[model samples]
Target: MNLALFFDPLADEAPAWGSTTLGAHAARFVDTFPDWRSADLALIGLNEWRGSAAGQPAASAPDAVRQRFYQLQRGTGPCRLVDLGNLRNGLTLEDTYLRLREIVAALLEHNTVPVLLGGSHDLDIGQFLAYETLDRPVSLSCVDARVDMAEEAGAHAEDTHLRRLLMHEPNFLFNFGQLGHQQYLVPTSVLAALEKLHFETLRLGEIRADVRQAEPLLRQADLVSFDLTALRWPEFPGYLPASPFGLTAEEAAQLCWYAGHNDQLTSIGLYGYRPDHDLLGLGAATAATMLWYFVEGYYHRRNETDFTSRRFIRYAVGLPGNPAKLVFYKAKRTEKWWMEVESLADSSVRRIVPCSYQDYLRAAQGDLPNRWILTQALLG
Candidate 1:
């Protein structure tokens, strides 16, 4: 299967906000990574946003301007951009969402993760709706320095996405790495509402201290979002609202690794990459690093599952808990297989345990394996 979908709207022609450059970053890194030589990843271009359909257009100035939004960074790979040239500005958000969703849905049909890079974070409001075109119980994971949830108790606010999401009611929402957020950006009441919903949070300091603390939370989500601005300015020099105490590209890469490493997650979007404001290709290169990290984790984790034999069931114990004290219990489903880990001796570490495959298959799926082959495992 094609591993990922690289979609760039080229909706905003301005050099800084263009997802095209970000897409190039992903392609370049994949080419540079030694492990990705055989990976079946494709960077496909998406239609231009032109700002007319409904979301905020680049200028929000006129519907008639054409060729207004275009941004592509330098890179080496098979990166394709769907150049719609210039789109009319008169289009409404509803119109944009409807058409854009159609395009996104087409990509998903091919088992692709529609990258949908660019235009505005407001584009995410539409991207969320596009996922509705597929299965239910859709979830979203957003990584940013601030809570885009600024719409409660006030008519107007920055990050209109908070209000937009409330209106759409996505199945669930998980937020990570929100540090140094100001009340003026999002009111305290809004944060309270989000907290009530069980949104996962990783403050800058907390995540920096240990990213493994967020493993379980990342696993529970279905779709994830990454706001490049979440990184500290020194680490990620390409975002518009860069922060001083944010995630470096490597740390952010680790977080993305966990998200893509999960089995439940189905879609991911990278938003808020501003190449125009970048210094000496730092932003583009970091964005590429983000994609490389995600794709690497994605394929690596996926290959860990073994499905060839019907009767056997297999699972790997993740590397977070201490393995020295983990004890496996005999599974009830099958006499030959072992069951769950009975004790976790240390909270500071995590360990992945691979048990009898046939037993889990029988218990979890009511079937037993005729043969078994362990494709890969992450129990270290």
Candidate 2:
């Protein structure tokens, strides 16, 4: 595929980039588009915002983010990064989505993680659709201030995109989890509907209490879509319906770091940025820093997932339940946890899932961890 055909090259005037800055290391489109095949990560910008629920346009938001991102220093690693320039907006909103899906799918086939800088949260629909070609179920994690499951007639794309994704044909979604949702911003009925489906949800207070708890959830995800509206307005004021209370900028970066560290994660979308709403470009800087931390985490991955290797310590805890015992593995290198769960349909089939030390303690005390129960339920 001639991927260059789908993009419009960067148009911003070049600035003096420092020796150690990302602009110096990344392959960018100046005279010609960079070769994406050699990249470990590909940055794609979406310049379409017609689907936004706010009924606003942000055609230049992508470049606004790039201006800040290009100024940051590169992380410690072999920097094989490519800037594919901004995607050419199609004649219609759906056409743009199809173009995005094709580009993302192509990048995934080459084992290159696509980091999308989006105009609105709805653009994640393309990110989700890209996985359809894999023919395997995938887990998705979404971070937003409110659940975007509106089903009303004539609803805006941003407000109803999640509903469309969850109901997408072929149904390859294995698990869906959401974090940093402010309870007051969500409808009670919507929460009930999600709970009935056994989907995991963490309110803002739960995540704020301990950001580390969100790590395991992110680690399990194959793709993540983050809305900037999930951040507190004081720190990031670039999204409509801004709130005074949400995740701090540091907490947002931490979650992104965790997402990047996951070996299974193939794509991530940073959405809900509006340059018109920003003050002093702080919001763009915040998003750029989050991308920086994500890259840092990616380069620093420990690759400690080999449970059968000598680097792992295994433990079996006796239980009073029908399962009889719960088995866990702790990686000596990273001290990360994973627990085994037997499929109710076939006891011979087992799956190892990411967990935390607290879950191990709960199992040791003869109590089933909520994560264990949820996984088991999903398996059944």
Candidate 3:
């Protein structure tokens, strides 16, 4: 697939550089698009908002984000990054979706992480579809204020996009989680529906209390779709549905850092940015800083997937009344934790899932961790 056919060169003027702006350090595939075969991370921009919910705010979000993002200094280790410029919109919303899915699949096939600058949160349907075509079972983590599972309601497709993703045939979704959801913004029925599927949800207050608790959930995700509307309006007033109570800017950046550190995570869509509503471009700056932290975390990756590594310490605990023993692996290199759940059907197949110190503490107290039960049920 010739991706150049669907993209345009970056039109934002050259950002003023002090000693080291990221734009100056990074190689971009703009103007004359270059071969991305060797790139580790490829950035793509989507400027369309046709599928946004009613009262769609006017948005040229890609450029607005880029203007601020390019001005930041490069802080990560040497990285082969390329900006694929902005994706051209199709005549219809469905066509645009198809184009995006195809592009994302192509990038993934080449082992390049695709960081999407999105138009609307609904555009995540296309990102999710790419994984389906790749024939990979994926765990999706969505950071949004609302559940967005309502039956086709208003003009904004954001309200129905999650439903579309869940209902799509050949469903390859292994798990789904919603982070930073506000209780008042979500319907009771929507919560019930997700519970029926064994999906997970974390309320905004829960996250605000201890954002680190979100790491395990984010770690399990193969892809993440973040809506800028999840940020408080005072910190980031860049889109419709701007709320008085949502994640603070620092908390939002922390989540992005978590996403970047997730070894399983491959694709990420930063969506729901509307440049029209931004106050003195503060929203753009906040979004750019979040992206910067993501990149930083990406570089700090510990490559600690192998539990057998000498850096890992094994701990075994006996549970009271339960015949099965719980096993945990702690990575001394990164201080990360993982719990092993042997498949009931296939003893040889053991699943090591991300866990927290709290889970280990619970097991030591002869308690079966809820996460362990959830994993067992899913495997069964």
The candidate that achieves the highest lDDT relative to the unseen native structure: 2
User: Candidate 2: where are CA atoms >4 Å away?
Assistant: 56-59
Q: What lDDT score is found at residue 45 in candidate 3?
A: 88
lDDT-wise, the better of 2 and 3 is 2
Q: Candidate 2: global Cα-lDDT?
A: 0.89
Q: Once superposed on the true structure, which residue ranges of model 1 sit more than 4 Å away at CA?
A: 1-90, 152-158, 169-186, 303-380
For candidate 1, the C-alpha RMSD (Å) to the true structure equals 12.3
Give the range where candidate 1 is weakest over 10 consecutive residues by summed lDDT: 371-380
Candidate 3 lDDT, tens digit per residue, 1-380?
Answer: 89999998876467566657777866675567967767877888898778864434555787788788888988857767788988999999898898999999999999888999868888998899999777767899999999988775353687788988888899788788889999998999999998777777899999999998889889989999999899999999887656789999999999999999888888899998888888699999999999888887788888888888799999999987553689999999788899998867777766798889999999999998877877776666
Clashes of each: 29, 0, 3
| Per-candidate local distance difference test | 0.47, 0.89, 0.85
| RMSD to the hidden true structure, all candidates | 12.3, 1.2, 1.7
| Top candidate by TM-score | 2
